[model samples]
Target: MRGPHNIIRLIRTGATLERTGAMKVILDAYEAPRLLRMVVRGVVWPFQWLGMKGDTSMPPATRALTALGPAYIKFGQVLSTRPDVVGDELAVQLRVLQDKLPPFPIDVAKDSVRDALDVQVRDVFDEFSEPVAAASIAQVHKARLKETGEEVAVKVLRPGIEKAFQRDVDAFYFAADVIEFLSPASRRLRPRDVIAHFEGVVKGELDLRLESASASEFAANTVGDEGFRLPDVKWAYSGRRVMTMGWAEGVPLGDNDALDAAGHDRTRLGERVLQLFLSHALRDGFFHADMHQGNLKVAANGDIIAYDFGIMGYIDEYTRRVYAEILFGFIQRDYKRVAEVHFEAGYVPADRDVDEFARALRAVGEPIFGMDASHISMGRLLSYLFEVTERFGMETRTELILLQRTMVVVEGVARSLSPQLNIWDVAHPIVEDYIKTSIGPRAVLRDLAKTAAVMARFGPRLPGLVEAALIRQSEIEAPHNRGGHRKMWALMFLGGLVAGSGAVALAVVL
Candidate 1:
């Protein structure tokens, strides 16, 4: 429950957003009853007279969220990936939620870095400079290390941004509550869960150390991976509020003229973009979730350098296998198995007819089959697949949704590099290779070796398990036992039975 002080802050935040035309933006995007919109409008009506002139309508949904603040900007970003909840048009609009915040004062940033890392910025860094870029969450400054003189990028958290986020997220939570109350049917969309996920994302991103750790983890995951690389994290200078990383220098993927002027191979880079993204998602369980053009760069050597590790996504091995099978089924043009995988994975409800789902999936995959590399559009195929998912009543999978949206953005970025590049052509080979290597006959032997290694480690514990069982048996015979020998014997017998059964089961699984 919110205290009075927090409630007051919520009201003020709501009024400010309303005054800024954010309320109207939501009202327009979300089609609720006219009466509801009007009623809500009536509540904020008094604010228009409070020294604010006419022409109060703000920018579109994307720009409005940007205007609202950092937290709302993140909300817009999340909604961009959630086409099922926000509808296609609004989700498309929300993709423009880029960070264009004005930089904080250099003194403030210096103080923040000093306080966060518990040292003078000058002591650790030489020629520390003003921020080159400012986002809603943080800003980055270019600097060189005092010890090694290695150029590094220093990112400092926005001062008091956490409190601002808390207040705004409180308002978001309140709105979510009202949404569920007013429209019970929307509960299936999991509005509260979505907000909770949004809240978690923003909160997690606030801690710079998490981002640094993600960068290191991602770097480790893609050590030998081709065409994709992560900037090295400077652990000594990074902390909860301040992060330092190896300076990344490359033409951003968005810079068409620069890319063309660099004389890079467009066809290869585009295919690499698609292939790298798929490999990241399917091969490495982790992916750089925010892979927009701004966060990616094309190095001089033609490798892709990714920045902004704050928003990473992970797909566990089980989901990876299911995903691979689904892709394999689609690649093979076996829509029935694709549908069956969904049912087998319980993604589609059992009551749903498998044949109907197959036909639906066919509708998504068939059109792109015979198209040449230049003609096929991966984005359109994914859009169709999303449509099929909605029609089949599949609930949202957050990880997969992020993957889907990232793929769209990546494919878009790839298209910018090579207008005629076929994404599926690049994706198909990568997915096929992964399926063959990780999910085919080779995987069986790999699993057996892994199982053998696991058993080798656990074999030492078997004696300990038998010793513990014997201890229990001895306890059963103790004359002064609390439970009495009869009860103890039953427990001992049951424990022994379970242990023996488990050993047999482990043997069979191995």
Candidate 2:
């Protein structure tokens, strides 16, 4: 399925774009060169008959992506946030891919719930309504628990979605391979690795149980966070194919009219959204990666309600520290420090000149600083950053893909709420606080404590390890000196252990 057969898939993709009248619009938005546009049209136009004939009422781009399957729909959702890249018209059209796609039949959803929970729908849900929202992987139904009489949202995986996603992912792998082979420049971005990461995330999302667990963990992590909340997971009602959580009542984040009607402060809401995302990413190292407007809402009391925990992002402590340093450097306009941090984290190749790289970074950062959100263009900034990374021999870090992408999407979401929001102003304090906690003397003590705990695990075996080292050293030395060598090695090892233990004690006391 991932072989030459995918050529057919690729052709169908292009043909769908052609037939739906999206090919030209997309090419034009991307500013494709004359020759490239001519070549693309020549290649894709002839096979337009092979394309899927999607709903005629939908916009061209939306219809094409919806007809293609879940993967393309997800792609469209991401593009929806990048109006600067896709153009405002197409971005508006693609917003439907977020949570308003046509849903499966209610009967089918009920059958799925029954099969997953091994109980009749009527027995478990006292009032199960039709799908209130549908997206790429799953749809949500407004329901009431029979036992507790509590309202909940029951999410059921689309029928045959696994096979649908796998098919599209296979085609994506083939396309990535072709891109890498045909264009040497694209290799630095690791197209295939990006697809592999997408595949892993989709697979995790397909299992409702994983989403339920993710929601639970995110809830626990954010319990202390103010003005942010997640719906409680209904564990007993959740399964691989079906998930249930407490119903969230709020106005969608995208509905500015409704938010205003409800007296929610859009500017403050925007700032809070950005701050919450940063806090989760830097402090907890785990965040809701898919934080588009569709997954967010504002309650009557102004608390932001987040639901649909399918795709999440996670960075380790070290990576989080590096990220914080880079951001803090930018906030302070310390381009050299930002460049140094990139090198220290091995994100840029060692051969790259730090001073020159710092200059390149300055080119990227300086333009955006002191500029209002309305003046700055994140899309252009990201494009320039991409070129800089490519020039410096920085390969795509797969672990940070979700984090980076979510940052872009979240920024878009925040801006939608408050068009004049200053992203840098909102982000500075969070990054600064993270840096203070994660990069100083206290951080060193924390690291030392962790190291000591790990070393303590080997404490019982130290004597045996020392004996083995001494014996090996004595064997390597002259036979006559074995006794003296053993004594000397023992003292050195014992002294080192004492010093290490003393340091650990001092750290603990401090």
Candidate 3:
């Protein structure tokens, strides 16, 4: 039999606490019982005292976050967006938790590629060089195409990373459970659900096929955009553990001198990037979800070639319309309309006063809208929105928060390259276009056609539906269909027996 999950959770929390020492400090130095504080102090005080001798330049908080490993670092990235969670200053500090690791051995990388594709290394490529970039999940290397005499990049997964992540995730869930059980107030954040979401996304990232699919989908979505593009996947050399794609040619966006020297138009490039991202989000309802500078490249033809599509986002047409309305409302200074839209979307509680929420949103919008691009701050808007949401018992939407985080990062890059770039200016046209296209007469006709097709497909089921309704009406109105009741009861009994037997068989096989 499986052991109690709660027991595993306690061990994970204790281990995390011992390694990080934040919990000990929180309990001992901040609040709680004297006895418990003393116990924690006695346990963690030695580590604080004797762990480092000299020249430990990194701050205690930094060291603690690092000690927690990739899971914590990723958490730090998420927390950096939540000014409500860790406060602004702490969030800023946590944003620097870089995800860098030494490259795995070349032999290991080759072995992984061979095993995943069931082919020899020499047969796969003309030449493969050492790693050019290394990250938590995988590393990339420059390679030559065998048939076309072209250059490409080979991305290989880190060996045995899934096991390591699974172990840490097990520890994370355990801690989240104990926190929720011990503190009734902690459940509001849904810590366990947050951990589960992180697990799903990260585990998905470990699969190269999923990432390739994301890249292909994004490329298809934005193919019409003049200056936007995604790397073309090399299907012949891609699988679950390996990805090969066209090697983009451009200096990193971080290098100002190279960008200037290449005669690149920084302002135009910035505008195109902002517009492209908004189009992907608003027009298509599918986006890159991660658009940091490292994942973007400026082509010689001025196309922004996006890479590393491990994370993608999707929303239905209704949600996209609501999102566009929110943006358009904000642009028009129609806070009341914005509040009404949120209520209509079931984002805020129905009982909450729309006028009051609008006033709060106004407090966030008016000051920022008046400022220039350099002075405006999305982070402040987020803070106000979170505070407003908390008052109405609004829970977090993981996808929304991730979208916000990416927007902040993308806007930062735009401003760095072109300081006068206004995100609102770039987004307004795209949002307006989406609103016009989706809410006009054409959309109505299209939706009507779709409904007609669905009705035709279900036309045969109408008789069954009518007969079932009549039988229900007869039973309810008369209350004496003994023959029908007997037959129904007998059929239900047989169905239960069959279901139970199948379940038992499945259990045995598993």
Q: Give the best candidate by TM-score.
A: 1
Question: TM-scores of all models?
Answer: 0.86, 0.84, 0.84
- Winner on lDDT between 1 and 2 is 2
Best lDDT goes to which candidate? 2
**Residue pairs that clash (backbone atoms under 3 angstroms), model 3:** 9-174
Report the C-alpha lDDT of model 2 over 328-425, residue by residue, as the tens digit.
88778899998999899898989889999999999898888757667564434554666688789886564564566577777888889898887877
Relative to the true structure, how large is the alpha-carbon lDDT of every model? 0.79, 0.82, 0.72
lDDT of 3 by residue, 1-510 (tens): 123654443344344555554554434322345655555456555555333221135334444555555555566555665544455566556666566667999889889889988998888789989999987788998989778878898899988887767766777777677556665565666778768777878878889999888888888888898977677899889999899898988767656677889888999888877778778887888988768788888877767888988777777788788878887898888999988988998999898988989898898789889998876655356556767777776777666666666677778778889888877777778888888888787666566555555545654565466556556756665546776666656655655554454445444434
RMSD in Å for all candidates: 5.0, 4.7, 8.8
State in Å the error of residue 117, model 1.
2.5
Q: What stretches of model 3 exceed 4 Å from their correct place?
A: 1-43, 46-62, 78-88, 476-510
In candidate 2, position 357 carries an lDDT of 96
- TM-score of candidate 3 versus the correct structure, residues matched by position: 0.84
Candidate 1's TM-score reads: 0.86
Candidate 2: Cα lDDT at 6? 82
User: Looking at candidate 2, what is the lDDT of residue 74?
Assistant: 79
lDDT of 2 at 393: 86
